[model samples]
Target: MPRIDWRSDSGSAVAEFSMVAGLLTLLTLAVVQLGLGLLVRNTVLDAAAEGARHAALADSSLPAGEQLTKQLIATAIGEQYAADVSASYGTWHGQPCTQITVTTTLPLIGLIGVQHGLEVTGHAAREVLD
Candidate 1:
């Protein structure tokens, strides 16, 4: 019978690294997902503002205004993300104003059967002379 000593095995370091790598990978993915969601929120707000400004023009008819708003939202947020989005026209301080409400669901990484759905609203007033 021969005695073997395993105290000097170098494979344990590799095994430890492998376990840490999985956790690190998950953390990285979660961060990326959250950052993307914030980016989308900002983009949606900007698009809403642009649409509202365009609609505020006196030359833009009601239907045209609505269409332009929708087009702007669609262009910025993909059709999937813009689903169920709604916009409304109103008057503020005797000037036309547009309000856009955007809604979308963000994917949750490493989370099972869980999702974060958020609604972000943006309002823009027309630069009309009182």
Candidate 2:
């Protein structure tokens, strides 16, 4: 090989590595954020369903269901996520049912996101004494 000029590209590798590393870091963070959002959503949904089932019992009341839902959410994530929980008596498929609704924030960046961005509801058939 004729006169090789190695000095011309001495710092080029560092510059290229920096650019690629930055992009990879951002992509990693985005994936982690998405996973967190999904986890929170699933947790909230499960809590609401459990609450509705509990409230559907003959001896349980709507307020009790709401409290259970709030407690479950607070235990899973944070107290703020447990806010805005409501339970109501309604009809589902023409049968009496207990419904629990949870409205909370959608986590985007480390458990901080748009308020009221996510809403989930759970329903269970009500138990009646013959």
Candidate 3:
């Protein structure tokens, strides 16, 4: 009769799987978190660009642009996401232009997770008189 080394290899696969499964779970969560952060950033950036374009019109005011930026962000994302929005005018290539900057928190585990973690800006040139 041959005796088996039950304690040596039995359930080794299960043990290894448990350890690897935890790491995989964490890696998956990290990717999801990164993706969410990027999505939020792109959304804010697009909103800022849209706001800048709206304000760059010959008939638009800086304040109007700022308001539009906030509204666009809030509508697309959330009101909290547009809490810190600003509009400014500056020169680009020696040409006058409107720049909209949106500074917002980055979501770590969820929205409102990180404080002052990320920032993005958008710009557009006003219609120049010919």
Candidate 4:
């Protein structure tokens, strides 16, 4: 600290600014990624719920629910998210019900991501007539 050469600071400002800008860019991307993930998740969940309700009808079948779920997801998001969709009959709270499940990948980059990144299910009681 005896003698500081001010000339040595040449280009220091630019270097520091570059680093900070990179960090800020990364942070922004992270936030955007999180939002995208949530959006995909919610969309898939809604599709599953719709499928479950459709299948729960007295006249509906499990395959119908699965198809509905896939269609919903395909329409809302894309065909990729609609993959691996399935429907099954089950009992919920001691009542017969239809369950729809969707398995899809998270969007790592614009709806393209790892396989089976997330799985979600929906259930609806069967509509019975007296």
Candidate 5:
């Protein structure tokens, strides 16, 4: 019997690519999703910290305090992403603290909706001045 020539097969490359492409695509999407999640989480944390800092100031107004937190995040992220930001102010350890929570969803074709989605939370605190 003669040895089979694998390279001569017409569908071999297509089949191989089809299998590997799906896995690679999925991996790329996962990485992107993770990066986005981390970025959003950090933004939320920073916003909260800035808000608390403003609130701790001697002459800071409530609306200005809220705007400072929202604006900081809006500058880092764009308007589309900025809309989801929400913050609440409170006291912790005698310090003014702001808890910022940001949430968004990503599309996942293979997983449909479960694994593709993510939720991130962050908190920050600052000492309140008399």
Candidate 6:
């Protein structure tokens, strides 16, 4: 057999490892980012729904619901995500309802993203006295 050239392949393993490691790092970061985005979205949606249910009570008002939503968001994530919260009266399935809307940023790179990139709304039937 002809003499093999080991020197030519000496750094090939390192180069291949570097490329694969970089790709794996990027993939891991992407998965983490996706998870964080989903967590934020679910938290915001839950907060909105809780706020709407609270406002649907007979003694609660739209402003109170908005405040609760803001507080929930601020407590869970940050004050920035609670910046744009609103509550309104509406009808769902012919029944009076309270609606809470939360508009916030969609996290792209570590909680930094385009403004108003995500919007979620929650509703609950209003409580009325006969």
Q: How high is each candidate's TM-score?
A: 0.71, 0.89, 0.88, 0.86, 0.61, 0.92
lDDT of 6 by residue, 1-130 (tens): 8997976767689899999999999999999999999999999999999999999999988999999999999999999999999999999889999999999999999999979999999999999989
Q: Provide the clash count, candidate 2.
A: 0
Model 1 residue runs over 4 Å out of place are: 4-9, 90-96, 109-116, 127-130
Error of 5 at 96 (Å): 5.3
lDDT of 3 by residue, 42-96 (tens): 9999999989898899888888988999998899879988888888899878889
Full candidate order by TM-score, most accurate first: 6, 2, 3, 4, 1, 5
1-130, model 1: which lDDT tens digit per residue?
Answer: 9877788776788999999999999889889888776777677667666666666666664445446656765776566655645667776677667766666655455212123376666666755556
True lDDT of residue 23, candidate 3? 97
Candidate 2 per-residue lDDT over residues 17-124, each given as its tens digit: 999999999999999999999999999999999999999999989999999999999999999999999999999999999999999999989998999999999999
Candidate 2 C-alpha RMSD relative to the actual structure: 3.1
Backbone-clash count (model 1): 0
Q: Model 2: runs farther than 4 Å from truth?
A: 1-8
- Which digits, one per residue and each the tens of the lDDT, describe model 4 over residues 83-111? 79988888988988888988899788766
- In model 4, pairs of residues that clash are none
Residue 73, model 1: lDDT of 59
Residue 36's lDDT in candidate 5: 67
In candidate 3, stretches whose alpha carbon ends up further than 4 angstroms from where it belongs are: 1-7
lDDT of 3: 0.88
Q: Which ten residues in a row have the lowest lDDT in candidate 4?
A: 106-115
Each model's lDDT: 0.64, 0.96, 0.88, 0.89, 0.60, 0.96
Better of 1 and 4 by lDDT: 4
Task: Sort all candidates by lDDT, best to worst.
Answer: 6, 2, 4, 3, 1, 5
